[model samples]
Target: MSVTAPRGFRAAGVAAGIKADGARDVAVVINDGPSRAAAAVFTRNRVKAAPVLWSEQVAKGGRVRAVLLNSGGANACTGAPGFADAHTTAERTADALGDSAAEILVCSTGLIGERLPMPELLAGVDTSVAAAARDGGLDAADAIRTTDSVAKISFRRGDGYTVGGMAKGAGMLAPALATMLAVVTTDADLTAEQCDRLLRAATAASFDRIDADGCLSTNDTVVLMASGASGTTPDEEAFAALLAEVCDDLSRQMIADAEGATKSIAIEVVRAADEDDALEAARAVARNNLFKCAMYGEDPNWGRVLAAVGTTSAAFEPDQIDVAINGVWVCRKGGVGEDRSRVDLTGRDVTVTVDLSAGGASATVWTTDLTNEYVHENSAYSS
Candidate 1:
């Protein structure tokens, strides 16, 4: 389907001399208004990318006019030089947008430990600025991809407002944010604090709950910007609902596109003492490579799920745990309950449910099955 760009946001994409493949590598998203409120979330990992560090600090003020992003090289672990390159990118973008350098957030994704091609990137910035247009959102989305096979984008329209987003990540994904880089734009009138609140809540159930592999990225980031172009402003509750829907759509897309993924798994944990407990249990299973691989082979390995949950402190009695796969009661009271042959998992989407019987809390985590292709893809990734 041909997705439309969000209202009031103009975008541009051009080759930044970063990708040797000759695909567009740099992108900019500009708010055409006088100013806009912004909120952002960054990788929880201490070893963060230079651009993430810069953007995190800039987002503290809750105002941003533009964002600069590049692919093909994650400006990470390069120490001071990487920071300088990131700052230069942001400064150039800000200059083009006629805003302060601090108002331009920056993001980068790709191979780590290499310095960005500054000369080419600087030159490309001008080209991107010149190409800026209202219909360039798709181009910008396409420019930020690395190992992703296809660009991931989504949009939701509300009363006189819209929420649009794009994300990229095919591997090095897990909770605590993944190797993903996402940009969400909205035309709603919202304060920086409100945006932050809505974003955090949305992410907790969406991106924050997905696991492709156990690995995390140094450049993970999710940013939201409000152009305030829409005159209609909804209440906090209404806005939060819409934000959740947008985030859910983006999160599902990310899981479906996981590198070497032939099947997507949704691990639902129910009847936990609280939300955190349910999430902890679900994530434990989501990150289990053995479990994922078994599922990939269409093996009804309920024991692996039990083992994963047992490793967590989620207050679940072993005998009270119930498991279901694709609506088949695979296990009851921690043991096999039904015919394993009845469950079918040849489809691209798979669902597994674990009932803790501890309380009323519940959580769901999305993950992908592990296969030989996954190993092969990462084995020679750096080469």
Candidate 2:
């Protein structure tokens, strides 16, 4: 259980035959609650998906009852008919739950530039609604996956309230949002303003720091719904901290299951002029595909790391930076320092630490290595 791990939440994932092989493609989550307060963060992509446009409105209103997600057609670039399908899905979900359609949010993922099969989608909605149960969290998590090899689920328990969430994305993973789709439910009492503020802050430190493939998804959506069933209101800072923890756990899960990734890398930028510089330097290295390939090969290539660090706007002296791979100082003062052969990357975890020596600020970004499997998996993703 993940999405339904929190009180007052029920979810279901159903096989609607949307996928050719009959994998579960539809999911439903209902906040059977005394509070319908909600908030969401969506993809910053200008050419948005139909479901994203629709859900943006729902999220803005700050109240929600049910969430319906399908993972077979992204419903992006499909224009008017796609929007119609998303609206219809929300309407059906609202009707099934005996709630207003305006309170229903819909999400879809898969191949872009294609229209969803409206008939099967609507039918799946019915099945998902009828199948919704308190124990269906895992099923819903499984249903939302596209190229992901494993389901991503996370939970954080507070004094009286608990947070539960599930995410799906293996490719098109980058900052400013990714192909990532996530749903979080909680039993805590929170106003819409608090929910919205917390979601942005939590994601900034979690999902925003991951760059698995460096490609943004038009269908990306992360939603948080509070049912207020716990009957307790924890401190705002406490709730926010727990939310960030849960988001970080889910982010790690996403990286571990990233498509065709042979290893996970943590790019840490330390001693920067400020947090912004640290973030910039870290992200620049994380998105360096050449460096990612080197990690896949277990090669200690410090030159690639320095080249990446130099591209960032972060304040740093080019000749003063130090680079470490897996705790081995491969490059010191922008020159070779340690023996390269001593740094072993045979394991799945790799860490690239860049010491700017510019200030005291630090930031960390997560990324995955590029591999043959990654190329192969994405080449046929739409098939």
Candidate 3:
């Protein structure tokens, strides 16, 4: 189950003819709720898609009844016409739901620098709205994919509420979000402000920590909608924890399915000067192509890790840093400790521990190994 696993939500996915292969390309999720408080986060990239621009305004209103998403064309870099198309999309969805356009959010993903086929997309919206059902969560998740080999969905049950979510991404995953569109639904009663605060915190600890390829997407979006249908006012802290877990689960799924990736790596930075320092150090290594390539070759190259860390401004001593791979301390105090060959990286999962030895604060960043398949897949991505 995905977003509709939560109470007061209905979702549907339909073949929209937007993708040449005729895959399900459009999805709609509606909150048929007693409360429609919503919060969302978008890509930090300066070059945002038209849907993102429109959705940001919708998020500001803090109330959303429906979200319309399409995966086939990214209405980015298309100027005013693209913006108009996005507006029209929201208006059409709003008309179908009998809600104001301001209460509808739109998200788009796929090849950038192109316009969407509005006729097919809007028709798909209408069809999905008519087909929306409580059990259509899986279908909704399946519709929002481009390079993803499988749909990503996660759910968690709380004391008296449930949080469910779906995401789509297989490449261009980076900090401040990824090349993804995610929708999360919760039945706990929450104010719009609470939704906003909790969503941001949850994303920061989850989506914001993953850097699959260090390439930010213009259409990245994550939305949390509270229906208050459970009729349970959950403890804020507990709800936040549950929401974070779902987001983290979806994040890991994205990494596992990253385009052409063979190894999913977790770079854990411990004993940093602060949480920010830990994040900086970890992200530096995660984004380093050299380190990613080393992982792909099943080589425990601690030198590559040290080199990446040296590029960061995080509080750390060059000679005091310690690096470990798969429980083997390959480098201790910035020098050789355990034999590098003793560390195994042949598995699909790898862990790199970096001891900053600065403080107690720690953070982890998820990433994937660089591979020849990744290069080949991206070379013809726009074709």
Highest TM-score scorer: 3
Q: List the residue pairs that clash in candidate 3.
A: none
Error of model 1, residue 147, in angstroms: 1.3
Model 2, 197-299: lDDT tens per residue? 9999999999989888778889989999999999988799999998999899998998887867889899999999999999999999888999988988888
Badly placed stretches (over 4 Å) of model 3 are: 172-178
Among residues 3 or more apart in sequence or in different chains, the pairs in candidate 1 whose N, CA or C atoms overlap within 3 Å are none
Per-residue CA lDDT of candidate 1, range 266-333, in tens? Answer: 99999999999999999999999889999889987999999999999998999999999998989999
Which regions of candidate 1 fall more than 4 Å away from where they truly are? 1-4, 171-178
lDDT of 2: 0.90
Q: Model 3 scores what on Cα lDDT? A: 0.92
Q: What local lDDT does model 1 show for residue 127?
A: 82
- Tens digits of per-residue lDDT for model 3, 1-383: 89998899999999989999999999999999999999999999999999999999999989999999998888888899999999999999999998899999999987777789989999998999999999999999999987788999999999999999999986443222236889999999999999999999999999999888888888899999999999999999999999999999999998899878999999999999999999999999999999999899998999999999999999999999999999999999999988887887878999999999999999999999999888767764544
lDDT of every predicted structure (CA atoms): 0.83, 0.90, 0.92
Sorted by lDDT, highest first, which candidate order results? 3, 2, 1
Residue 140, candidate 1: Cα error in Å is: 0.8
Candidate that would win on lDDT? 3
